[model samples]
Target: MNSDYRKPLPGASMQGEPVDFFDARQAVEDISPGAYAKLPYTSRVLAEQLVRRCEPKLLRDALTQLIERRRDLDFPWYPARVVCHDILGQTALVDLAGLRDAIAERGGDPARVNPVVPTQLIVDHSLAVEHNGDDANAFEKNREVEERRNDDRFHFINWTKLAFKNVDVIPPGNGIMHQINLEKMSPVVQCRRLDSGAKVAFPDTCVGTDSHTPMVDALGVISIGVGGLEAESVMLGRASMMRLPDIVGVELSGRLAPGVTGTDMVLAITEFLRRERVVGAYLEFFGEGADALGIGDRATISNMTPEYGASAAMFYIDDQTIEYLKLTGRDDEQVALVETYARHTGLWADDLDTAEYERVLRFDLSSVTRTLAGPSNPHAHLPTSELARRGIAVDYPRAQQDEQAGR
Candidate 1:
């Protein structure tokens, strides 16, 4: 950690007082004048982690990449936590159990082995709908069926909760992992106390097992999806190595039409971004249209990150983010911390006015109509107005008459 960059955050009352945070903006500006003010929101959060956790000796070069928009060198990213569904989570745990046994055989203390980072495994994917929704007892029936079908797997998952440290499991029927993460798990900003008794705050970031994990990016947390092996590495406290991604700015303008839904806007965006070739880019969405949206609408867009082929879909921290945190029932003190830290550290939306991006794309919300995706591909933007011309919306009676006439 770079103690030189560690500074106290004002107006943040964690335990009746303020807490410390890594001064990432200062660090960036020291290298290049006015560079921090131009960094995208994603880069700012990444820089904070590097400032707080990256070795002091390597800090300057890492911040240089973010400031200068270079990606030639690899830097370290230590995700704050890992989230997973039952299947991949089980696989990673099984691998760890095997490792423990191997260690025991080599005269090592297997009990000492545990996940270094916090992990949450939700048992969401294994349920089979044995009864349809029309049945009032459908949920109960399906849950029963799932319990019976996966008894052994459930037993192992239960045992892991106790046998392993830093492992928490959410049993089946609660909700989908991505939805639960957005509504419940992620705290836009997280706090941890150092051994010296000083508390420090940083953005809540995570890696999840499913692709839809980016759904929580709606909350301004830099959550991303990774495969099981990548998740395991993070779980074991190993840094995910990476060069800076292509951080693209998506400036939204205009208001959505009255009848248009968030789904409509996202479908359109998916197609536009795909066509624009944003694959593997980290996207930061800002502007009047983005500000007009609630978190639910933002989540709708972020949930389809893979459809647009972007690594992440991010929104800036602003009043909308604060409101959503309150709506989701986050702690008042934590909420205050989020606002205070962001404003003080140049993470607020207002602070981003001068921010620059390597590439910028403009999207108009009003331009989006009642839209839909392809019959096959998610990015195949299919507006409802085009359905008939595209031969998708057939006249039922005409089709039947044609069939009768063997046309």
Candidate 2:
């Protein structure tokens, strides 16, 4: 905290103490002159997190490795929080309780075992798709079935709310976790008070128990979906170790063809990227095409990151993200904070136009047409007009005739 970059924030917390932060922009400039500006937004964010969170002695080595793109060295990533849907989220909670019980049996302190970091458990997966559509009593009926079937899981979840120190649960019948995160939970930039009595501001990042957790990444938050085990590990204060992922720039140009929804664009892009074998890379969307896309459109692509085998699909912090924050009813002060932080930290969209990548993929949005993904695989984009050619249409009369003749 003795560096030139460590600056105090302009507020007093509930404890009335001045908050401070390690200025990531300054750290990048000090460690490697002019390099921060060259990093893609994702790299810039990762650098900032490492600067603020890593030990000072080890900081130089990690910073150097990141700037030089040394994939061999792994660094620590401490997420701001964890998000979980009931399916895997419940499993993780049950595992934690089991861990506590095992510790107690061994005479270790059971109460000491709690999720150190904030954990949000949304009961989004409880309803069966069995009762979907048009029925006025559908939700009521599904709730009954969900409660009856998942009574034991629900009991554990309720206990976790009271038993764990930093656990919050959203009862069933709420929307999906990813949707909730996009609309409300993720702040893009988080300002919080530390136990050390200093409040700090940093980019909002998280790991979810489902693969589509990266949906919030469309808003320039770094969220990844992880397994329940990994979520538990992070929950217990373990740093998630990761090699710097390959940051691939995807340059988009041309407006979407008329009638081509964001879904069509994503399906086309998914198919293209999948064939290009973009596994393990962070896909950064940019160019005029990217700027033209709405946050809703961007979220569509980010949500499909896992299907294409990418680690994260990210959109740079731009006016679009700020507009989205406003439209979602975020407080004016928070929106101001997001813009100020992003602009100053070299994470904004305009700051990235000159950023270079080791590899680049070009896609023209005009090439996309209105299309639907598969009846099964999401990447299988079959145009409605081509369905007959693909033999997806059944000869209903022929089938009925065959059935009547007992053939």
How do all models score by TM-score? 0.94, 0.89
Cα lDDT tens digits for candidate 1, 1-407: 45778888876768775699988888888889888888899999999999999988898998898988888999999999999999999999999999999999999998888999999999999988879989999999999999999999999999899999999999999999998898888878889888888889998999999998999988888999999999999999999999999999999999999999988888888889988999888899999999999999999999999888888999988999999889889888888999998899988999999889989999999999887765678766678888778898977788899999999
Number of clashing residue pairs in every model? 0, 0
Q: Which digits, one per residue and each the tens of the lDDT, describe model 2 over residues 49-123?
A: 888778778777888877787887888888989999988888888888999999999999998888987999999
- After superposing candidate 2, which stretches have Cα over 4 Å from the reference? 1-4, 9-19, 102-109, 132-134, 384-407
User: Residue 189 in model 2: shift from native, Å?
Assistant: 0.6
Task: Give the worst 10-residue stretch by lDDT in candidate 1.
Answer: 373-382
Q: Report the CA-based lDDT of candidate 1 relative to the real structure.
A: 0.90
* CA-only RMSD, every prediction: 3.2, 4.9
Q: What residue pairs are clashing in model 1?
A: none
Please, what is the whole-model Cα lDDT of each candidate in the order they appear?
Answer: 0.90, 0.85
lDDT of 1 at 10: 74
Clashing pairs in 2: none
Q: Which residue ranges in model 1 land beyond 4 Å of their true spot?
A: 388-407
